[model samples]
Target: MVALSFISLVGCEASVATHPVSGKVVLADGSPVGGGIIKFRTKSDEGETVKAHGQIQPDGSFQLTTFQDGDGALEGEHEAILFSPATGDGHNAVAAPNFPTKYRKYETSGLKFQVGPGENDFVIQLGTR
Candidate 1:
């Protein structure tokens, strides 16, 4: 399973060779927009599409499985997008919590990422008005 612990600002460390990339999605008020999908895709040396993707947690966190041994898209630049369908008036997480169907996965294409091997920090700012 994937690890989901928060990183400390002090001097803790991770020893795995495989790197991790993390980011945050928030609204104009600086509140997090949680629970959706995040995907990263790139072409391999053989020209085949290599995709590493996962879902954002309820608190707006996400982790995608990158290949070990420094051989994946997490080592370089990538693309990103956020898709949440409800307007959040009365249909959002606090009221409904879970969507009736699926997370809106293709509603926005304005997100992009240039991730590094160990840790790439990103903050996505959005508005509801």
Candidate 2:
């Protein structure tokens, strides 16, 4: 049938297939960091653009869902990027409501990681560059 053929064709392609990515973002002080960007990048063994994107969450928690056929992300060397709540683009962001105003030290620059297929638990500890 056409539906079966379409599914077969989709399975033949290599892409970020269906999967789930879950993790937590925190500061070096073991405190939760809220409101920032998290970027995931993967490079194939053949130097191909595997996958890349920036996911943002108000809290230090995230879950990336990959779909079937078109959602299975390639497994390989991966990197991550995390922005802090205290500093953004050198503008010197203010402290979060959970912390004191003087404690403006939760923002982070770029984070890195290695990703594979399956559930992944991550903790991002942001430090000054």
Candidate 3:
């Protein structure tokens, strides 16, 4: 049973090494974004793509996880993106608080980060323009 379970887990994801990544999201004025989801995506040297993300705390802090909680992301250049929470349910839903719309898309967001060996820390500050 242990072997079977291990195989199942291995089948789900390739055994790629991930480094610890944690950070805070703040506005230009140094205020926390408050609430949202932040994602980091990158392609491995072997052409495999890995993604990691974490829920933003009320203080804007976050810790990334690729497979397990706080396991982090692969070592490489990562494209970043943020998704604000919805204000209402269903059709009346609106984006959380206020953040630039560009942040919703990785390409236009102009957000990038480098993940290296060991623990990685960052402070993502949102720009006004």
Candidate number with greatest lDDT: 3
Global local distance difference test of model 1: 0.54
User: Could you give candidate 3's per-residue lDDT for residues 57-125 as a string of tens digits?
Assistant: 889899999998999999999999898766687888754546678988888889899999999999999
The predicted structure with the larger TM-score, 2 or 3, is 3
What candidate 1 gets wrong by more than 4 Å, as runs, is 1-18, 67-73, 84-108
On lDDT, the stronger of 1 and 2 is: 1
Looking at model 3, residue 30 earns an lDDT score of: 93
Question: Tens-digit lDDT track for model 2 on 38-114?
Answer: 55656556565544433445576766533342243456555555443445455766543343322232223335566
By lDDT, the better pick of 1 and 3 is: 3
Those runs of model 3 whose alpha carbons end farther than 4 Å from true positions after fitting are 1-14, 86-95
Estimate the Cα RMSD of every predicted model relative to the unseen true structure: 10.4, 8.7, 3.7
Q: Global CA lDDT of candidate 3, please?
A: 0.86
Q: Rank the candidates by lDDT, best first.
A: 3, 1, 2
- What is the per-residue lDDT of model 1 for residues 50-73, given as tens digits with 9 covering 90 to 100? 556655676766666655422324
